[model samples]
Target: MAGRNMNVYFQEETYSKIKNLVAKREISRFINEAVEEKLKQRQQQQKEELRKKLIVGYQSRIKNKKLQKILLTYGEMSWEDLSAKLEEQEKNDDNCKK
Candidate 1:
């Protein structure tokens, strides 16, 4: 495959190990594969983190929609009925907060 040639450096100890273990002509290939593997790992981690954030955001929206429904129910109640309903809703809010 066609590739760019650029200067690269490694610590003396690491370079020694790489030269000892890898064929001299293949050191560039070894470093390239290592970089590719690390890139894949980071990309996968970012995708997973974004997925988790999306799920949390969706759950929050659903909770807000339910609260809106509850508010509508209260809006139709008589003042005398509202106190009991408000107290019930407060208890539910406390439970959900935990």
Candidate 2:
């Protein structure tokens, strides 16, 4: 990639630390590599977060489809039958918890 020249200012203490850690001839390369590494790490982190969000959204859509199917199956049933079914489901859930 082509590079551009830009001036960057650092605090005196920070500059001193870098000077201490790196030879003057290699300071620019050291800073460039550090910045590139940090950028890559941030990009990877964002990708992972996005992947997790996509998985959650996909699972939510699947759950909605399953719920829709259940509702459709019960569409022709009477209100009393639906209420009884709900009660039975709640009882089963309670039993599982116990």
**TM-score (all chains, Cα) for each model:** 0.64, 0.65
The 0-to-1 C-alpha lDDT of every candidate, in the order given, reads 0.93, 0.94
**Candidate 1 per-residue lDDT over residues 30-93, each given as its tens digit:** 9999989999999999999999999999999887997889888878888989988778999999
Candidate 2 per-residue lDDT, tens place, 1-98, comes to: 57887799999999999999999998988989999999999999999999999999999988799788888889978999989999999999999999
List candidate 1 stretches off by more than 4 Å: 67-98
Off by over 4 Å in 2: 67-98
Where does candidate 1 have its weakest 10-residue lDDT segment?
Answer: 66-75
| Cα lDDT, model 1, residue 65 | 97
Per-residue error for 39 in candidate 1, Å, reads 0.5
Best by TM-score: 2
